[model samples]
Target: MAVAQLVAGQNITIPGDRAYCFSVQIADWQWGVIVSRQNGSLSLLDAIEGASISDDRLLLNLSDIPEDIEKLTVYIAAGVNNTGNRTANSSIAPTAGMSARLSDLVDAKEYASIDISQQLTGQLAVSLIEVYRRNGAWKIRCILQGYREGLSKLLESFGFTRDSYAAAVASISTSASTIATASAVNREQTDTQAPVNQEAGDASITLVWKSGQGSLRSAARYFMGKNFKPVSDLRIGCFYELENGQRGMVYSFDASLEGSFDGVPYIKASRAQNQHFEQLLINARFRHKLNRFLIFASMMDAHDSWGGLNVDVEFQLPGVAAQTLSPTTLMVKPIYAVAMINFNDEQTKMTPLDEYFQDLAEMDRAFAWGLPWQCENNSDNEDQT
Candidate 1:
C-alpha cells in the first residue's frame, strides 16, 4: 500500500476518468482575510408617511432612509410648538452646531407630532443621526444601522399628508427631483375606468397605455384639508361601466407605499417605454405615492403577455392636513395580486400589442377579480403585517 499527500502547485492522477483526471477543481472558498472596517454604505434612516394627522413620525440621520420604510401616510398632528433645538452626544464633547436644524414640532396643547426638516450639520465626527422616541413620558434614542431594518421600516410606515401628491411632485426642489417628464402614460384612456373621486377637485390623474413590455402610469391623489391623516388604508380598484349601466371591477389593492419618505425609500420612476413590462409595477405603486421604483415583467412579443420581472415600490407622506376624510366603515380590499395570460409562444408569441391588452385586462382582473380572500378580511393585515 502507498500513502500520498498531494499539495498546492502539485497535480496527481490515478484512475481512468478523463473528466476529473485532467481538471483541477476547488470546492472550498479561500476568503483570505476578514477586513474589519466601519459600515459606511450601511444606511440608518427610516422614512415615514402618516395616514392621519395624528400618526406623524420620522426617522432621520441618513441620506438613505426609504430603502426599507414601509408606507407613507398623512395625518394631522396636534400642532406645532417651537423650541430652540440642539443635537448632543454624551459619548464625547458635543460638536458645535451639531444641533438638529428641525425640532419635533409637537402640538402645543397636545403631544401630537409634526415634521421639521433641517441639516444636522457643523463640526461632527460621529456619522450617526439622532432619533427621538416618545418612551413613557420622555424621549429616548433609537439608531437605525446598529438596530434592525425590520424595526426601522415598521416604525416609519405612517405619516401626515397635507397636499395632493401631484402638487407635491411639482414642489420638489430641483436638486431632489428624481422623476423626468414624458408623455402622460395611458392615464387618459384608463382614468375614466379608475375609481376616481372627481368631487375631490384640484386633483387630476395622468396615465399612458402601452402594449408589449407593458404600460406605465403614475398619479398623485390629493385630499383637501389643513392637516390630513389617513385613518384607514385607502382602497384602490378599477371599474368599467357596462352598456346596460352595469359596472365591472378592475384591479383593487392596498400596499403601504414607501413607508419611509427619504432615501432608503424614495422612488425614481421614469422612462417612456416598457422594455419588459415594467409598467405593471408602476401601476401597482400608483396606489400609493412613491419616489422611486423598479418593476420587471415579461412580454414574449409586442402583442401578448405583460407582467412584472419583480417589483420595487416606495412612498413618502406630506405634512399633516388639518382635516382628513373618514369613511363610514372599513372596506374589504386586496393587498397583493398576480396575473397570468393564457397566451403562449405557440399560439401567437406574447407580443407587445397583446401584452398591452393583457396588462389592461390584468388591471381589470386585479380589481374585479382579485384573490378569493380579501386582505382586509385577513387577520394578518388587521394585525399590521
Candidate 2:
C-alpha cells in the first residue's frame, strides 16, 4: 500500500495484525519525542546528541498493549541548549526539515508520514499524534496543537505535579551533553549583533482601560453616578516572589521595587499618568532569581466595581507576538487577578487567570501567595496611572 501523507488533524487506522514503528527524524539536535500513556505514565526519548537524526523509535504492537491502556500520545518537545531541558521560550523554533513517520516492520514500508517542518512557530512543544483504541481497533490521529507554555505546562496537563515534573526534568538532564549546532550558530549570530535599546532579555506589561460605551452607556452613567472611577483611578499591581522565597508587591502607592534581588530593579510601576493606560516594565534578565510574578488589577474605592470599563492587559516579550487578555466581560468584581508569569531556570510561562475577587486578601489566599496583606491600604493620595 502507498504511504499516506498525513496533515495536521488527519487520522488513519492501523492494522492490528502487523507491528509498526514510529520514528522521528530531525535536521538538528534541538527536538525530542515524548510518549505518554493514558495512565499518567510518561517516557522521554531524547534525540541523539550532535546528530541530525534520532536513533530512538517507539514500537507499536496493538495486540501486546493492555486492554486497560486506551490511548497513547506522542509529543515533540523543543530542547534548550541540548541540555535535556525541554523548557523552550518564544525564541525557540524547529530545526529545518524535520519529519516523523510510522512504518510497518513486516514489509519495511511506511504506513504514514508527516512533514513536521510546516505549521510550527515559536511553540516549545507540539502534540504530534495520538494512538488510541476506538471501537476495539487501533487508530492514530495527527494533532498539531502547540504548547506555548512549554514542556512543564504540557507535563502538568498529563497530571504531573511540580515536584514530579522537577524530578523528570532532572532525570532527563543527566544524559544531556553538547548543544545543537543550529542553536550554537544562532547564539553566535545574536552575540555578534549590535545591542538595541530594548534588549531581548527585557519584558514589559501594559494595562489599558476605557469606559464602556454604546450598549454600556447606561451602565457607565450609573457607575459615574455611583462615583466609580474605573479609568481614572484604576490600579495595576504585581505580587512577586524571589528565589529565596521573599515576597513583595509593586503598585501605584509603592511605585517600584528596586535592587530587590541584585542592584537591578526587579519591577517598576510607572507613576506617569496616561489618560488611557498604565505600564509596568519588568527586567526579565533577573528572571533567573525570580520564582513567581502575579499581576492583578484592583479598584481603590471599595464601593466601586469594575463593571463599566473594558480592561485589557498585554504582556510583551522579545521576538514574540504580544499576548493580550481582554477581561472586560469578566471584570464584575472590585478585584480581578489578571495573570501570573512563572519563571524558573529552564523557561518562563505566563498563565492568564481572569478570575474575579472580592479583595486582595481573597486573591492572595486563592493563589497561596502568602503575601503580607496587612500593608495593603486604600490610599487616595496615590497618583493614578
Candidate 3:
C-alpha cells in the first residue's frame, strides 16, 4: 500500500531498456502507468524513445496529478536520462541528492570503437552522483560506483592496467600546527621542529593533535558520501596520535568538495573555515616542511598505463632523526582504480600497471597541469620557521 509520487521535471528510467517515464507517477505504485509530457497529461505506454541529452530532472508538476493523490512525497532528483552511466543536470541544486556528470560515463557505443592506441582516449569513472543545493553543496551517495568494467577498458590502454590507475592527492597545511590549535599562528611558517621519525624502514610515531576535534575526508570508496550524513568530530580520518601510541580521527574543519566534469581536477571547496584550514595545511605540507613532494603527488595526473603513484608524505615527525628518505625517499601506493583494472585485465587481456608504466608516462604528463593539483600550491603560514 505504498505509492510513489512523481514530479514535473522528474525522470524515471524503467528497469529494462524499454520505455522512459517522465512527468508522472503511478496511481499509488501501480506498475506500468506514467503521466506523459507530450500532451500535458497522464498516460501509460509500453515504451518511449529516449535521448541522451535531455531533461534529467524530475520536476514535480502538482497541477498535473489527480485530485485523489495524497501524500505528495515526490522523488525528484536533479537529473535526466543518460545513455548509460553518468548524465549531466542543467538545473542542479547545490545540495541535490544525486547528480551525475556526462563526462563520467563512456558512451558504450563510443567506447567500443576506441582503444589506448587511439587519440583523445580516456576512461570513465562512475561519475559520482552528487546532491547539489542552492548554497552550493555537493554530497556523495552510497549506491554510486566510480569506475566500472567498461570504463576500465578505456583506462587499460593507457597503462592504467586493467586493475590500476594513476592518482595524485594534494594536502596543504597552514603555517604550522595552527588551524586547530589556539596558539596557532597564521604566518607561513612554524617553529622549526625536529623531524619526528626518520628511519630506513617502517616507523610509527605518536601523532599529536592540537586538540581532540576535526574530521578529515578521504577520496577512497570507504569514505564516499559520508559528509552529508550525521558525522561527529571523531573518525573522519584526521588523526591524533597520542603519547601512548593510540590514534583518533577528528572532525576539525568544515569541508566542501567540487570537481570538474572530467574528474581530473577536484577542489576542497568552502570559503569559511575550510578554505582557511586548507591554506594552512597546504602551506605546511609544501613551503616549510615537505611541500615539494606533496605537490608532485597531488598534481601528478591520472593515466591508464598509470604506474602506481608515489606519495611523498612529509608530515611532522615528532621524534625520528631527520635523515633523507634514503633506501626509499617516498612511499609508493598503487591507486585503487589501477589495481582494479589490473585485476580486470587478467580476466580480460592479462597485463599489469607495473609493465606499462614507462609507455604511458609521456602521455600522462601532457595534460597534468590541467588538473586541480597546481604546480606550486601553498599558502603563507604564521610561524616563519
Candidate 4:
C-alpha cells in the first residue's frame, strides 16, 4: 500500500485499529502533548497519559480510549526562547502496521507525514494535529492552528485555567491509593530533614552549600534547629533588563570588556570575577527597579560526568514565613532560576511576601535559564551555542 502523505487540513481514516501513535521532530523551542477527549469534549482539564517527548520529537499514544471519547489531539507549545524562524516534521503511524510498511510486499505505507516551517512571532502555542474516530474507525487530521499569545492562554481556551488544571491533576493522583500510601510514608521521612522556623522580620534568603568542597564554618549558622551554609566557590548572579532599557550586570568588573545581559561576552564569571559577593549585594539593592530578574548559580569546576553534590537555599521573605529549598544537586554547571517578583512600587510596598508563599515551591524546576551561557577559557564547546 502507498502510505498517505498529509498536509494541513488533510485527514485519513484507519479502520479496525483502536490505537495510533503520533510523533513530531522539531528544532529547539518546540514541545508537544497528546490532548485527550471524552464525550466530544476535550479532557485536558486534568492529568493525561501517553505523552512522550524525545530529543527533537514528541511521541504520543492513543490507547484504551473510552467509548464516549472520539478523538485525540496533539498540542505543540513554544518555549520561552521561541522568537525566530523554525521547522518541524511529524508523522502518524499505526504500531501494528509498522512491519507491513517496511516489508517487501507491494503495498502502500501505513503512515502519514509532513514537514512544516514557519515564522513564529510571540505565540503561546499551536494545535498541529488531530486523530479521531469516524464511523468505528480511527482517523488522523493535520491542523496547523496557531495562538499568538502563549501556551498558558492557549490552554485556557479549552476551559482550563492553570489552577484548575493543576488541582485536577493533583486530585486524581492523590486518589490513587497505592501511590498515595507510598508517598505519605515517604513524605513523613523527608519532612524530618527540612525544618522551617518562621520569625517576624524582613525578607532575607540564604543559600547554603552542603556538599562538594567548601568550608562550612565562617558563613554557617544555626537557626532554630536548621543548618545554613554558603557556597563560597559558586557564583549566584542575576541578569536584568531595567525599565530604562539599560540591560547588563549591575557592576562591570572591567570597563574595557564589552558585555550585555543578553549578548556576549556570554561569559559571566569573567565579568563577575572576584566580585561575586559585591554583585549579589548590588542585586539586592535594586529589587525595586528591576524589570526582570534571572538568578544563576554556577560552579566553574562542575565538568566531571561521574557525580554531583548537594546545595541548599533558604529564604525569609518579609512578612512571609521562613522557607528552604534543601539539598539540590549541582548536576549541571549553571542552574538558573527566574525570580518572579512584583515590580510595581505600590504593590511591592503593600503586599507582604508572606501572604503569597506559593512561588517559593518552584525553585527545584530552576534547572535552566533558557538563555545561552558560555564559560570563558573553557575548550569543551558542547551545548555552548
Highest lDDT among the candidates is held by which one? 2
Backbone clash count, each prediction separately: 87, 0, 74, 10
- In candidate 2, position 242 carries an lDDT of 61
Model 1 error, position 111 (Å):
18
User: What global local distance difference test value does model 2 have?
Assistant: 0.60
Clashes of 4: 10
lDDT by residue (100-172, candidate 2, tens digit) is: 8898633357889888878677777777888788888888898877787766666667676667756655665
For all predicted structures, in order, the TM-scores are 0.20, 0.40, 0.18, 0.34
After TM-score superposition, the amount by which residue 30's alpha carbon in candidate 1 deviates from its true location, in angstroms, is 53
Cα displacement (Å) at residue 102, model 1: 17
Lowest summed lDDT over 10 consecutive residues: which window, candidate 2? 256-265
Q: Tell me the spans in candidate 4 whose CA falls farther than 4 Å from its real position.
A: 30-36, 45-63, 80-110, 118-122, 168-385
RMSD of each: 23.9, 22.3, 24.1, 21.0
Candidate models: Cα lDDT each = 0.21, 0.60, 0.20, 0.39
Off by over 4 Å in 3: 1-8, 12-191, 194-385
Q: For this target, which candidate reaches the highest TM-score against the unseen true structure?
A: 2
Q: What is the descending TM-score order?
A: 2, 4, 1, 3
The list of candidate 2 runs beyond 4 A from truth reads: 1-199, 212-232, 254-265, 302-307, 318-320, 328-331, 375-385
Q: For model 3, how does the per-residue alpha-carbon lDDT over 1-385 read when each residue is reduced to its tens digit?
A: 1122322223222122111112221111111112224223322222122211112312221222333322111122222222122244323222212222211111111100111112111223322221121222211121222232333332332233422221200111231234235223322222244344422221211111122111223333256565422111110111122122221111212321211111111111111231212221211111111111111111112111112222112232222243221012122221111110111111211111221112122223332312222233221111111
lDDT of candidate 1 over 1-385, digit per residue (tens): 1222221122222221100000111111000000111331221112222211111223222222123332121111111111111123211222232221112111111111111112222211211222211221122121112112221122233221223222332343232343222213333323334333322211111222232121121111134342332222212222222112222222213222212222112221222333311122122222232222112121221111112212221111122111111112121221222222111221211111111222333444433533223333222222221
